[model samples]
Target: KSKVSVIETWLRKHRLLYVGATRHPFIHSIRDGSVDVSSFKRWLEQDYIFVRAFVPFVATVLLKAWKESFDATDMDVILSGMASLNDEFAWFNKEASKWGVSLTNVAPQKANLDYCRFLESLMSSEVEYTVAITAFWAIETVYQDSFAHCLEDGSNTPEELRDTCQRWGNDGFGQYCHALQSIAEHHLEKASDDVRKRTEAAVLDVLEYEVAFWNMSQGDT
Candidate 1:
């Protein structure tokens, strides 16, 4: 029998933590149409900052991929992702305006700062390509899964948030995430045992950070 992929094994082993990141109470509130607008506003502002920080991390990943990946298409996929960030920023600005959110004045919350720091750590040269890509996959997957849940059938996600939800929840984004997963898994299959262990730990850290980010959105410390 073919063995389970590294990512699949880790996901199964850490199912609860994965669920916590993707199905936190804040996400449920959004799905139930009970989300406080203040919470949404807080998330909007904080996430904009997070995405700004995320750009550098993605760039670092792209650079690593260019330097380490044997496959030229790896660079192509990552480059496309980098190019797409421009559109993402435009959407964030438009949405913030619609909601009266002033993105310029928003300060990063502690959770956000912590998460950004984690990204910075992964960008170091000492980190292996396998481990860094795994963290990248986890970080993007959490957002993709969480927001996609809000768009699922039977969810009562508010109309005002539907656009925001669709931005990440759409099939195209899902496909992009799948591409990232494929890249991560491919690298992981050939990684050293030590690198694999570090990758697993990084995935767990990403989940914790995601949960804390949601908590911060809800005004929790």
Candidate 2:
């Protein structure tokens, strides 16, 4: 039986998450095993920058988790996720070598900058823990859902891309995303109506920004 999630239900009602999860041209092409090297490279470069900024954004969230939410398990998971970014950074460097691209001087593009700025906004004192963590869960799950499709039974995702896909799509990451969802849900349950609305809006904003970020990679922006 499938598990139920309030966030999942809310996201379904809105469709923003669905649009971001599916219909991303870059991810769709990867599923077909026909992603062009140029587009993939652009995605890699932009995503690397995003990940770099992601480190500190998540760190700030971890701080909030400690000071605000006081959820020990959630803090542990956030810490573990923060540790993994080191390996993720290494993977980007190694993957760049395999593809013969120089990532040494790449800069953040428009969509990525906007996304990072959104994270920065969440880091501000005005944003509550529920809103920030809701955004975190939404953003990570988008990538998880998008990439996991590539590993599906009939997917034509190329062997070369499968490793990258599985990096975010694998069972462990799925579990991590679930943990984040649980944390968000637990907080949301106690939240006032105003905070709940803000959280739902955060999810929508994350999806919109994610779709735009994907479009930027496809040169559609």
Top-TM-score candidate index: 1
lDDT (C-alpha, whole model) for all candidates: 0.92, 0.86
Question: What lDDT tens digits, residue by residue, belong to model 1 across residues 1-221?
Answer: 99999999999999999999999999999999999999999999999999998899888898899889999888887887888788999999999999988999788999999999998898888888888888888888898899999999999999999998888888888988899999999999998899899999999999999999999999997
Tens-digit lDDT track of model 2 for 175-213:
999998899999998899999999888888888889889
lDDT agreement of model 1 with the native: 0.92
Q: Against the true structure, candidate 2 has what lDDT?
A: 0.86
What TM-score does model 2 achieve against the real structure? 0.94
Clashes of each: 0, 0
